[model samples]
Target: MQTADALQLLLTPDDDAEPVLIDGLSIGAAARADTTDRKKDVTLEHFWDETGDPDDLEEQRWGVIAPEGAAGDRLIALIQPLIDARREAQGGHEVMIDRVPSAMSPEEAARWRKQHFDVSVELARDLPRYQLILGDLNEVPLALQQHQATDGFVGRLCFREERAYEAYVDKVLRWERARAEAAGGARFFTVHDRTAATTIGYRSLVQPAVAQLGRYKLDVADLGDQDEPSPDAFLEAVKRREPTVLFSISHGAGAPRGGWKTEGDQRDRQGAMSFGRDKLSGGDLGDAPFLPGGIWFMLACYGAGTPDVSAYWHWLERLKQSGHFGGQTQSVLAGLPQGDQRPFIARLPQTVLANPNGPLAVMGHVDLAWTYSFQERDTGRAMSRPSKFVEVVRATLETSRVGSSFRELLKASIVTNVELTSLYDDAERLGATPDPARLGHLWMLRQDLSGYVLLGDPAVRLPAMRRRLKKDAASAGEPGVRVHEVRAQAPLPAVGPAVAAERQAEDAPKLPPDMDIDDVERAIGKLLSGSPIKAVASEHDIEPKQLSALKEIYRKAGRAALGVK
Candidate 1:
């Protein structure tokens, strides 16, 4: 058994984190030890100072990592039983962790990750189709030397306290039991703006899927208008619908160190979803329900952690297309080498798992995410169906472990980028012109793979997908057609002939189909704030019912968005 002292010392992280020093060992500054309260204190040491909270646990893993050769083998021997115990409990799913052999140059590190990611990507090639991924996202030197962090690669996010992991597992088991008893099937909700080009590209490609793809009913809450996209709408939807799977897309809210309130600072909003003028910070979720057996995909920047600055350099070209260098300058500044100084703000995905009522697992980009990740070429033409991430995640929903799917998707993305790069170079050498779009996408794919991180139990399987909603031949001809299942009933709105006519007229308007609901609500707010509603509505061509829906949304959560009592 690992002693409290050994646990404390082994998990203790250095005050200053740099890439591997010449000697390979990080010179850590020692500090006070409290073996309890792992949730608040779990850290990589960069976020806290020695004089800070005295009860914080060192951010390092208690006993998972080990150097290559005999030492690593020994550590694995000790840890293998613990992991085996978990794998055994899961039955069908397996998570295999390999120690990173040694420290090397950044280039070598890239190769190292690529090699592992490549290995992970090959699920079902000769193995099971339900494969997932497992990673070691510990800090440098430690990660380089085969050590673990508070958060393991199995996708259980970060468990900060001594019993956090145990509690998380217990919750997962509870979720499994509930899933076994529940009558409903997998209910999924995805929220995103349709008007944004990136959003359109993503939704157009990812949303429409084979009806029988998974044992889940997919529901979407389109942002209708950015201003009208209320956080309440999402929360209410979750509360009402009780979606087992939730996917969100938007800009993440994060500012430099000083931009946040003391103790309740920017880290609170690091992976927060931007909703019109308002946002859903991790702190806001204190009142949210926990999705114990659920999986969340946060399609936003830094929803995980900011990866090595190199991850964002690929966007410079995309910025150059804006005909301004200011954005390019920021990209350059952001990507500038701040050696050994890794800027990692705590992320939202982990927060979701950390929540008492939060979900079982949340996967997201560690840094900025881009469109190229999901876009891939089949026979050399760009197409969006079956994105690497989507394929892996969907597989997990069916039969694989959370970590396996994440790892496999990550590997496929990385390998695809490498292949594209080689193809580009080959075309150039052969005196042939390479497609510029293909070249651009190559960078995005590579960057995306590097940042993709899953925070939750690697072994946690998505609730068994139940085919309860079979297609009705009379109303729907298809076999796997979707029909809403009644759970908790809500009162229907009072409707009259006049209201029916009004709704018909509203439905007939030429409104922007892609406008987000939140944006619509925001527009209504501006109107309430004394912007001529009739004139503005006419000019913008808003339909009557659409306009009414916006107002109704305001009624639901207007005061909060407007920032008043």
Candidate 2:
């Protein structure tokens, strides 16, 4: 409502600062659909034409629409009034209408241009407000026409599709609707108020509490740009300062030449891949420095994809091990279509920044899809909206009652569930039998118990399988299936020949009178560095305390000691 409030809402969590939801459409789905004649275009058109008129509608509402025909008029009618109402409710605070383009056809283009002018006139004639038209008008005819009508109009528009348009509308309207409801004495929307009070303006969709979280913008280095920042430069930037969230929209490769290609054949028609190496190897992520204390939203494919070898490490794994990020840092909302990165990149920052804490959950496709199958979970809700994901994250974060390591872990679980679903779909297509061992272990690690309910198939009792796994582990006298024991490796401290010989002498069975206490300590230190003190003391028939005290002396001398850091 206030200038400060508007400014705060404008600051998003991601770097792109683009709206996640535009004109009530989900950018991710729209981008995916743009690649193919998928549900994005069809659904958008249906919603726009079939849905009720925004001007005639009374309830505080939001919906998606096609850019053609009367759909744009309905959206304009619906959104402009909400914006006006928000301004009035906020004590004459001016509302801003930011329009993003959603169509490219000449006919559709003209329609969009007309819609904008009509909406602008409505705003000017009805309410005291300001509007900012952003994004490209893809249709050349409309651009030319609009340019002829008003100077600089072409420059003000961006050619982004309808998905972005609808998403922005939804966010703005929802925010304003919430504000209007909160301030109730003089209703912003009433049957009697026809002209001045009839219009509703932009509302702040971001929750007041959640809006306080730190915001950031995620601008990925363009790999194709000759002047673009190198991986090292990017790493250095990250090392100097870390954001609460990192959203990367760079290109990614899968495994090496011999490994399976998850998306498509990387090789061109001439059998040449973009990168020099064979298979699905990624660009030089290993060389990049990671932000230790932040969450990474990898928009790249295979950034978290598993490696080919059994024990070999992947880039995500290495990043996780580098101590720059938590266990969840390696986690990603992957499998998104390459084209959809722009919309995701634009909206993610705002969604994350709008939350009181960092995003408690991140959801992404394992593979690109024109239709967002994930949204089936929330039926009747606007499928194209960005606020859907925002709502899920908000609810998840609130369940924590604040924040905790467990909550972060829960966030990881939800992200993993989404990834697993995508993987399940992929595996089904590839005809790979679901590995019960892997599935069981993953189920055990899941922090959200409700996830088990979503497993859908009762045939695979993950809990029972995990129990069997535990029994096998106990019988084999090894760590359980889900646990991995990594032996620590580092060079031993250098000791002189005389010191080593003294240590050997101390180690040799000798009477107490000949034993040098310092030499005994050095020998104990060297032994403890490699083996546990309990094992060493028990094997050599010495008190654990004596072994501990001796080891402490060497530790004081700057020698290496092994244990948890």
Q: Estimate each model's TM-score.
A: 0.54, 0.20
Off by over 4 Å in 2: 1-237, 241-243, 249-283, 286-288, 306-565
Candidate 1 lDDT tens digits, 395-499 = 555434565456556556546645665665687689895555454445445545556666665555565432223233454534546566669878667445445
**Distance (Å) between predicted and true CA of 384, model 1?**
3.9
Worst 10 residues of 1 by lDDT: 4-13
Which digits, one per residue and each the tens of the lDDT, describe model 2 over residues 275-384? 11211122223323233223333322222221112111232244345542233311122222233222111122223212222221222211111112112212222222
Among the numbered candidates, top lDDT falls to 1
